[model samples]
Target: MPEQSKRLIQLLENEGPMSIKRASAKLQVSERSIRNYMRQANAKSTQILTDHSKIWVQERKPASLDFSRALPQNYRERSSYIIKKKIIEKEEVDLFDLSETLYVSYSTLKNDIAKMNQEFHAFQVHFRLKKDKLVIFGEERQIRKLISHVLAQETATHIIDMETLLNNYDKNLVHIIQQEIEQIVVHPALSKNDLAKMNLILHLVIISTRCQENGGCANDALALVFRTEKEKQWFGQLIDHLQTRLAITYAKEDLEQIQVLLAGNLNFRASEPSFEMDQKNIRFTSQILDLLEKRFHVDLNREEVKELFLRHLHNLNIRAQTGGFIKNPMKESIRQISPTIYEMAIVMAVEYKKYFQVLLPEDEIAFFAIHISSWIDQSNALNQKLKTLLVCPAYLNFQSDLLQTLSTRFADELYIPHVASSEQSGMDDGYDLVVSTIPLSTVSSQKVISLSPIWTPYTQQALSEKILKIKERKKGEMIRNHFFEYFQEPFFSVVRKTSKEALLHQMCARFNEKEIVASDFEKSVLEREKACSTAFGGFAIPHPLVSSARETKVSVALCPEGVLWNNDQKVYAVFLLAINEVDKRVFLNVYEPLVSLLSDEEFMTRLSAQTDFHAFSSLLIHKIK
Candidate 1:
């Protein structure tokens, strides 16, 4: 049930049938509207009345004639009764004190009690004033049923009416629809008309879901399907647009089938699969082709699907061996885009009869691998090693050539190369470090190192010294088991020799059982394996984003056992990063150097050999320099 309807029902169940004025105040609606709704409800219940005489004879009618007349006059009195019930059922409340809170004159409250007693007697219910409190003694089941009926009446008359559904809740539904439309909108194969028609069909589906009844004919459904003349124009425009967008002709029968499926009273479960198939066979293929040609600027034909599939499959196989699976990542990306993307993909797959043939499992794996690889590569280029400028004599083009040589050697390690002319020297440009071809006349205050313009062994040795000095100054002090110390108390103790799942569970228990660590972190770490493999040379850095956890902390685990991570490598160190916030600049700066060091085979061999925590810390601190 809808939340509004459920809440209304709960309110009526607890408070009983109430006056139009009282009910409106409780529900925050106008009294006139509540009265009109009650009249309609009474009209509907007329046939259910057992005694004809009682229905027609005013004197014979029940004193509590309808729900609108049954509520208590003052809000305080009603509130007291509600609180009293909860405490009585659950075991405590002081009702005598509650009466004092209502602030009603004692005599006025007595008169109100007398009125309730006279009215409830007609329904075989008694209102007893016990110890200065009101309690209803009556048929429990019958009272509950009446309350449920009253709530249902209010929902049908107020909440689910045309104006409320269209103006209030429809915005959220329309947003979802718009997202779906964009997915198929720019397809190269689809004309403007095809996209418009698909949008119309979706709009109609939204209207149908909000309809009151499900057994209506297409004509009746269409009447409720659209509310404005603009909607009618959109519907007509959609049909015209589809005709021009699709190369394959859709017969009159196909148009009728669409109308009937959308407007007829079939349940969504029964209609959705068939609707998807029709879209795939006719709409999606044309749309995809249009998008590729127009938006992506790629010309694609039917024959290219096979080649694309093969290439994707090969990449996927290599990734699967390294990364665990691609299904979850693809699903996540698609879900993030919009709900419509998922719906559209499903429809296209079903209609084209390529639902099972496309090897989506592999395609998805390749997509995530490409995404993560590009992200890592860009991050490394932007922030890895410091940028340096080589200032040489203007006469010797050797300085410029040396810059190219360095760029080619460190292409994977640094950003694009920058060369500075002799005139530009001593300018204090934003370069992180400066390597001078000759000693400058001005005393160099900046990080300056002199170097020869040759790739000879002597020059290489001199360059390494300068590079080491820069690295030592840039990389700061290590954390020194600070993270471990943060969780040293009884509430956060060590979880030794535990499985990954067990450790995760223990962490959750220590913090709060309600805080759940995202399972996707494991999937993301595993999925990262497929593309080139996380085993970069020898070390692997496995981390997940802040959204994947409720808390953020880098859990560094050392394995002297040297567990095999991939076919070509073994992991001696693992950094389980639990990022949960955006202010992780420090963490981001450290990530590149850590990944780079891990990539070195010699570093991993030494890291695995180290036994003590001090030795491990010393090795890391030494490497930073």
Candidate 2:
């Protein structure tokens, strides 16, 4: 079966039924092609069923996929196959044999090897062909790290477990390792999530397989040290269990690397400081907090928050030093949930790279973001609560009951300081929300919610929805007030078609000519774009990796013909933001709402069709209102 058909089946199984038109749009195929894919997929197993104009999965019966016979079809898959053969499977392959198996030309196979070498540069590993036979050479530690990365990329769309493990590893070996991990005792502060535990089992299997095949990973540079006796005891027991169960012995360096991996994966949250933390960790934590304050205007220097941060930093430092980092499975979800917190985490990562000269992987960055988000949540809970006014008419003294329900439900979200009758509601217009039993004739400008005197599930749900809308409206209003200030007429353009680099260059040149941005602004923006595309929901938000603009300004480009932002994605609109240091907070204030507004695909499609800035901006402001 074609790869697209398998992907279509996976999509339907994961994301429920979708109309043919919607599926075609999402898969970047024609309606006819979608139907063809459905037919091909259904012919294999009859799992895909179509009802009217929609397709869905009836059941996901496992298919006996013979990976050995199925040759890799793309550069990514071919590279993964080659790496797995050399590293995990410990097999050497002749170039001619591989070319014949992959159905590629000899020269093409050599070119692929060159590309793999280039990609492997960062991991300090490389592939070399000795007399047309492929062999991999690198530090054992680096080799394992590369294997972890390759495994992650291969199984990105699926869960990591026995079923997935069987695709690449020996089933009996995997089960043996899993059984041992299940028998071992977990630490108190370690994560007990089944997924994390499964990941540990997978890595241990990788380590044992490699060591058993070749030899122990012995490096004199790594010192085996444990901070506390609990950690030491834990490490000793784990190694002893693995050695006894597997009939193998591990080197000190392998033990050290294992300890680092444990620290990276299992260290979820900090408890009381087991021993006095190091001064280097203390200094790094203080610097990060100060940097967060300076860049985002966020002060996370409270004693409790600082202490937790310091403890996490201790583990982070260990990973940096030992060159063993765990991959985060929830990295994408965390990034999508709170982009603002993730952005703050990126700032910390940049500082980490500069201070430690070790680049933290995206997984490690996501883990650090967990800590920062918790601290921010704590600070927001204590300091920021919506001031609410409850207005219920005097009817059997039921106003008290209604207020009590609200206070209990939204204790952390709302602060109800005043209770007034409908007639007395016009006296105060200062609260963020006005909840009333009776309709208000006046106070037209206030955010008013009229509900039943008796609080029911319907009323509670309505109030919850209203509170969310109120928050978004206030956030939208903040950006709307200064919308014109950031988006100026001179910075607006209507382009029939353009490339990302061309558009960025034109805008950055204009800004540079007007002395609005530094000369290196375009370079920074391009670097950031290459690292991660800013395109989202048919629009792109391109910004610099670092803020050093003379003045903060937003440039808008309406590409009615659609400019390609990334592979398989064309952006109809581009929002290029050049932010100054002093105006960083302003950027944060508007970034979320701006993304939210542009994320409306239908609205953006219509708005981008407008030829003039006046029409586009007007439609945008009206929508925000």
Candidate 3:
């Protein structure tokens, strides 16, 4: 059985029988999947759990997955591993033999090799499959670094076990290499994460072994910005030492790439000691914020948002340099749950294009989105209040006393903006709820809650309850009004294809045809996708980095049959955004439906099938409300 079966049984026993919705969300699986796992678990064990159609399993002592359990090998991971090993071995690897050993079909292995070739493309390396064997076609250094990433994955922790590594290659050669790197790489110092450190060591071993095979990495494949001439000379001296010791000539490009791997990945303290953040990092972070201000009407200059973004940006710079992407396992759930924040984050990330050459991955963007999510919620809570008007025409003391009482009782919930006479037409103003000594108008009778002029506690309690109910109604209206405003029939459609790129292209074209967006809006959306995919669940919420549209609206398209969204997911619904300055405030309200839409497959299927605009609009608005 799949491992999910065992996990399901274990979860049920530990947490009690869970509803499918709760279990699926916790397990990161679909409701149908959780149910299927339940059935599978029941077949193998006497333990059972039930709750209508939505359920998990129960206790089975001594329970474990079958002992002979073998993890289904991931084709991509294994293929990369095999290719890297073969390339480092400096001999053509027989495809037919390797495929059999890996318990995979030869044809599948070939496809993996083809994909690997693409990774090698940027690094001055390529692979050739000839004579029924795969051959590495690149310099020694590039070859080794590529292969080392594969070996590093074999261990549980990112730190390399030198003992295990030498067992596979040459022990003495690696030892010499270790001794040399320790001697040269010193001074102001560079830093390394566990993974980067392993990568560094592995590349050294590769260089040492390849020297024995009369090989070296190409030099100067790409130019890199180094800190100073002294540092450049120091790096050059180290490379020269390696060449002399190994009796191999290193390519300028190979040396350049290695320098980047070392200097680029390692963390170095700022030269100045005064400020907490390095001046450069501080400047870069500030620039990013400034760019965001230019793009969105939403104010992100709040101290809390600034501090959090700075912390994330500092890490992101390091990650970009080292190609270090700390996996955000919560990425899917975060996007699915808080899409408005995620959407804003996506657009904010576009501003990075102006300052930095490297782009942060979508995972990083999602993490940033999470930071913004907290702020938005806080702002909402702080700002949600019932606008109120007070009437006390008879005496000034009465108005003052009543105002003071309401403020004391409902400080956070009520905004008492007006205190007026019975003739002030206060009720005609746009106050949400009215507190009056006497009724002002026939229209305001229902909203005007009469309160005691003596400011009694009993009267205060009743008014507070009434205000709470009004606030709920206002909140509901906030969502309903904005949603209905944007999601008109003209904006909705059932797209024929689900490919994210194609779908986005078609949606943007529609927006342009309507003259809703600038010509570059679609390009911006695609650029965002290139940095990190926007695909979440069966939906892709693509938008420009900055809202430069004629009007703010979501261009809706649905592909009932899923299309490949990114490396890992597929999306069926595509909501291409062209948000305006005004719409930014209601973004969360607009996208709240996404959280529900992704969870219910049956609903999304019905949505995708609803080609009629009126029916689609009604069904969607109904489901959401």
Candidate 4:
């Protein structure tokens, strides 16, 4: 007997006197359908349903036509027949052999057999299995029609021209394409093309999964799609090219998504070239760089400034391709690097560029920079310390009152010191890096750092570190006489006395017989710049591209009379740096610390104060600690 009809008979017998409404709900079907099923049951067996809406059953009857239409099309009838045939013939068949002959997955065959047992109670068909085969004991004719009806009603969708599609690509190639597609789908920032690719890869992966489950041939045409030697070689080349250009690593998931897209018949269109730069964009970048140098004293050159703008554009292109509508993380990183008004203006440019093909408005960029400038000023104010005197002069009472007012208004990390007279030192013992109200002579020799009385607390904090840094930098600049022995020339020299161009040339001559090897010079300069800015505080350490010396050495030129660089701050000191292999070991370790010391104003002042190179070197080593 068919499992469905037999199960229906059993349900009616167990739940006696139940209405079709209750039965339909329990069976997950419409009440009308349940009633029709019950009517069909009544016609098939008089004992199956009682008169006047009550049902009674003797033994369960085999399933009827009413139960057949609801069964799944795949294997439903075949499973029922196999069980029934086995019982009738009293013969066993291997389940594995049956699965192979049926051209169905082992799991599907197993599920079908399991479902027969689960739903058999309703159909009144008893199921049993021996070592190799299943048995179904029930009336045959009724069950046969029921199973046939269900199989006919169940819907099935056909696979799209699998053979032809598989034939187009080798099985290995298909596998590769499937893998790439799967990766694209799982990525966070997916473009429309990425999504399409994902779907394609999924289609291929599903087919591979399906084929594997059915124990098919390992080397199918689909697998050859991504796996062919020529295809793999091309894929490797493409990956290398993209990585080199984009500075991005493709994840395994990305590869999977690509494979899926290709397998599912998708394509990725290349982006069109863009060349035009809007005037607003160019002006906006120029203005920001101008403000950075003018307002914050950051000495960024024209090319360096241009590179910053280019980085933002690159970020925008990447985000656009990824279907991202938000500002890129690069903007935030730049803000963290230097929170100047100019940086904020660049951020605005990045945001507005997405909306218009042309450049953004100049006023908008200026407005952002202005607002940022105001915010930075206010912040700096909050970080400043106020100068206070405790001396009782003729206007002591008035001065005290004024000091109180100043303390309330602008004092942060404020200092109040006692003074005997106008000439007396008013240094606070408990303050951090004290400044006195009296003249420099009146101050005690207690290593008290000096700040310009005109300078704000923000400037004090910034300059205090700057000056101290300069003194420490002197240690690294100390001349090593050993270099002269190896190179048969002074370890360092000053060329044009004023021009950075002259300094670079002299440094190059020390390394190469020619003053400059254009290619090597450019490459070295770029590498040095990338490592860190050569500009330490107001001093620029411009040197040769190569370290041709035998020993690590530095030639220092003290321009106590500062030279003009294109920017605002005068260049005070230039260190001609030459490092042999041994010197590099020490220099690399100490370079950052030395750079940091240049930020201390006191150290820079002390270093600048020294007349002799030995005195400068002594002060430098002392300050480095």
Better of 2 and 4 by TM-score: 2
Q: What shift in Å separates residue 588 of candidate 1 from its native position after superposition?
A: 6.3
Q: Please list the C-alpha lDDT of all candidates, in the order they appear.
A: 0.41, 0.67, 0.58, 0.43
- lDDT per residue for candidate 1 within 1-625, as digits (tens), equals 3343344444443333323345567778785654454445445443112121112112112222221333335733353333223222221223454345444456666654554433223234455566766666667543432222222221212222233333433454444434443443332212322322332333233333323122222232222233223323534554445433321233332343444332211101111222223333234445544532332122222321222223333434444466533333223332322221232233333222243234234235323322222222222224455666666664555754566555434433323234555735344466666777777555254467677776777777766676666664564432332333211223222223544334433443433343324555555544544454544544445554333444445555565555466664655665555554321444454565667667777887787666555676578767763
Candidate 3: residue 468 lDDT (0-100): 63
Best by TM-score: 2
Q: How does residue 434 of candidate 2 score in lDDT?
A: 83
By descending lDDT, how would the candidates be arranged? 2, 3, 4, 1
Report the lDDT tens digits of candidate 4 across residue range 1-625. 3344565666654433344555666678786776666666666765455332233453322112112323324754566445533532223545776666556666777666665544333234556556756655666543442332222221110111223234433455454544443443332212323323333433343334333344443222222235223334545554454333333444443344333333222211111112245566567666655644343332332431242243334434454565543322122222322222333354445445533433333333433443333333322322223333333232534343333332332233333433333444444443333333334564444423443334466645654564354334333443232223222334333233466555555555554542212336534754675576576667777645575343344556566766554456566666656554324543554556656666687777667656765576667666655
**Residue 229, candidate 1: how far off, in angstroms?**
71
lDDT of 4 at 417: 31
Clashing pairs in 3: 191-267, 218-251, 218-254, 219-251, 219-252, 219-253, 219-254, 220-252, 220-253, 221-253
User: Runs in model 4 with CA error above 4 Å?
Assistant: 1-497, 504-533, 546-548
The Cα RMSD in angstroms, rounded to one decimal, for candidate 2 relative to the true structure is: 25.5
All candidates in order of TM-score, best leading: 2, 3, 1, 4
Q: Which stretches of candidate 2 lie over 4 Å from their true place?
A: 1-385, 392-408, 421-425, 437-442, 452-455, 546-550, 580-589
List the RMSD of every prediction in angstroms.
25.7, 25.5, 30.2, 34.2
By TM-score, how accurate is candidate 4? 0.22
Worst window of 10 by summed lDDT in candidate 4: 151-160
lDDT of 3 by residue, 30-91 (tens): 98898788777778775556633224343211111111223227755565546533542222
